[model samples]
Target: MAPTTPRPPTMRDVARTAGVSTATVSRYVNGLQRFTEATEARLREAIDQLGFTVDPVARSMITGRTHTVAVVILDIRNPHFTGIVKGANRKAQQLGYNLLFVDTGERQSAEAGMLRELSRRVDGLIVSSRMPDADLSTLRDLDKPVVFFGRASQVGVHSVSADGRSAAAMLGRHLIDLGHRRIAYLGYGAARWDAERKAGLTDALREAGLEPMFFSADSPTLEAGEKSVGEVLMGSARPDAVVCYNDMLALGFMKQAQAAGVRVPEQVSVAGFDDIPFARFSTPTLTTVDMQSEAMGELALERLIELIDGTLDASEEMLKPRLVLRQSTAAKVRT
Candidate 1:
């Protein structure tokens, strides 16, 4: 046969090339049709050669599945939340799901509505922050799967979190190991997680027959860290070391110490949790515990997928944290 100039392809063209019906080609493109490997490969190749394109909106109408998962996050500006988004987005793509990110911007009512609205369209959901007042009830009423990360839910809810308890323990033990007899924990002191972390710190202190000095902060802001640490340092006796709730707070405490003309390690030692990217770059760096943000996201996404597929039971899964020692921590020195 003489060489023939191939015509640009359409659904019919793809079907003819693949030796399948036009309807078959259409269904395959819309993901409404299942196919054998050979048939799928042939259709795929034909479409590629023809530069075939389908309107995703139309495809969604036909298939009834957008292949999208909505990820509702609180404050994308937070480094930790950003890390979870990164991991969840990558996994969503790997699993053939599109990401529809909704930032709550840290508003309770806004998050609640966005969550409910997103839940209606997405095949599943992954929420990064604590569910707002009605958010949990909404998730409970949702027909699709939902998984929470770093934030916990009700008794029956699914959550993936780093071992908050262990994180405190590691930091505490590290300080005790350095012969710091008196340590303090400073953070948003009343939160459930904060309490758990404090327990771990006290546990570590008890193991070494030491006592921990605690100064409760209203929040984890750097200002709070600075003020709290200042009070501790100004007390009758200064703690040999202090463990902060997170890197941000730790950095603040470190700054306060510097301004107060205290010699670090020689006068005071500081440890922090949540080894955010900035933790390693901080001045004098920081001795912190890594919450394994990416790993937490991965596990949360996996758990969401499982809940969607009905492959695994919804449950709380905790990943352990690791201690990161840097220039900021050293053996205690009596002033």
Candidate 2:
């Protein structure tokens, strides 16, 4: 027969061992009351000898707080989201809070479902949404504190994001200055950030009297970039340069272009937004924008915690974007 488990120690057992009343033990253990130094020392010794641990669930039942946060993002496979998770997780651990991460797989419909379910279990949320402003507006009714990441909402959700339009305009101006007249844009489907970047790039190009070529992908993955390269190249009008939505897409285009023997920065210059880790290690280091993902993550978590603790005021934060010039883009050689 299996050995019987020893009786788990209780507050009464601790009180008996420490020569204190059970009510005194309960109050001291839960920080509801203070005790004399000698008494506190005796109670600590008793607790240590009993090998007792406080159950978080039991404590939450008494205090009405789970001390946990939910972080919702799209496409965990993307390094940008992973970086945000890392920063957010680090802070959550330091503050004795549990983190629950949910990936919506870039589906706007799935986000509403996640928000509904997870809000019941966690104290607050940090959401990087793919949903439209109208859909996000409904989150105002969610009974928990929330902070939005990477996109702003008209629904008055506290938001933290990098300026995508400025970043795109900067990249477009760089390409235009380098003699890239016919520029192609490879972007993902509808999203506020996407529209802002696209409009910024289009405006920059049009200002220079250049017609911007547009190509789109279902997702912002490497496969999407590889699959769309053929149509972009096979068109009647070929672009001398391509600016991609993100580094992942640009990497895909580079992979396919190299396989087809197209020289990068020689025949066509390529650039992307979001200077992820692989952007620096690529064959020809990618020219891209750094959106400060880690900083964004940290700020988002800080804001969420403040919201949860009733210390944060509703506000919007926009981080600056930096350009990392590299080997992938060059001065176009006019033939």
Candidate 3:
């Protein structure tokens, strides 16, 4: 024969021990109402003596809120996303809420499905998506309050993002000042931020009476950057400087270029966006833009909570980007 299991203390047990009504106990436990100093002390003592704990599931059922938020990102492996998640998690924990994350693998199809499933389980959402503007507009219709992390929409949703266009323009002007005439941009075509970054680079080059060259990478990764070396660095119209979409690509391009007997900065300068952790430690170091990813993440979570509480209107917040100079870029040498 097995011994019977003991039952956990309930709100009724706490109420009886404190000599208070169950309704009063419920109000106190759920923070729905306040009690006098003497009454509160008795309740606290009773709860301690009875070893009573609030059941989160039962509380949520009664309050109609789980006190949980979900974050949807494109790629978990990218340090940019990692920084965002870290910030959101910290903010969530501080506010006594839980965080749920879903990686959509940079696929738009998967993103939609994941959002639908997550909306039912969480009180709000923070999304960093790569879907089209039309698809993004539909996010406003989701059952939960939504805050976009890296992209903005016209459909009246809250969003937080770094100023990528301005940052890319700053990088472009830096290369131009270095006397690099044939400057080219290498980027992933599928990225939602690619168009703005390209436009920023184009704007800077046009101001200097020069046309910007464009190149595409299958994805924003080291391998894609390495593979483009032959076509971008060894072609007839080899660029004197290259601005990659992210640090991963810049480092990869530098590695393969050096392996092929080409010198970095000396022959071809390189720069990238997103000053990831490894950027400064790479060979020759890397010149990149700091997107303030962690701060944006924290801001996104704050905005989402405000939206959930009906305290904020639909608006977008754009953080400024800063350029970090390093040894990877230098003035072009006259032939």
Q: Say which candidate scores most in lDDT.
A: 3
Please write out the lDDT profile of model 1 over residues 156-239, one tens digit for every residue.
Answer: 568788888888998888888887887888866434467778899999999888878888776666777788766888889878
Q: Write the per-residue lDDT of candidate 2 for residues 1-335, one digit (tens) a residue.
A: 99999988999999999999988887886656888999999999999999876687886786677888988988899999999898899888877788999988888766677798889999888988777775777566688888987554466678899999989999899999998999998988665578878988998998899878998977899998888788877678989899999989999998898888888989889999878999999989999999888888888888898887788777788999999999999999978
lDDT of 3 at 214: 94
Write out the backbone clash pairs for model 1.
Answer: none
- The count of residue-pair clashes in candidate 1 stands at 0
The true-structure Cα RMSD of candidate 1 reads 4.1
TM per candidate comes to 0.87, 0.85, 0.90
Q: Please estimate how well model 3 matches the true structure, expressed as its whole-model Cα lDDT.
A: 0.89
- TM-score quality measure for candidate 3: 0.90
Off by over 4 Å in 2: 1-53, 150-153
Error of 3 at 260 (Å): 1.5
Ranking by TM-score: 3, 1, 2
Between candidates 2 and 3, the one scoring higher on TM-score is: 3
**Which segments of model 1 are wrong by more than 4 Å?**
1-10, 30-34, 131-135, 150-155, 190-192
User: Model 2 — TM-score against the truth?
Assistant: 0.85
The whole-model lDDT of each prediction reads: 0.78, 0.86, 0.89
The lDDT, on a scale of 0 to 1, for candidate 1 is: 0.78
Q: List the residue pairs that clash in candidate 3.
A: none
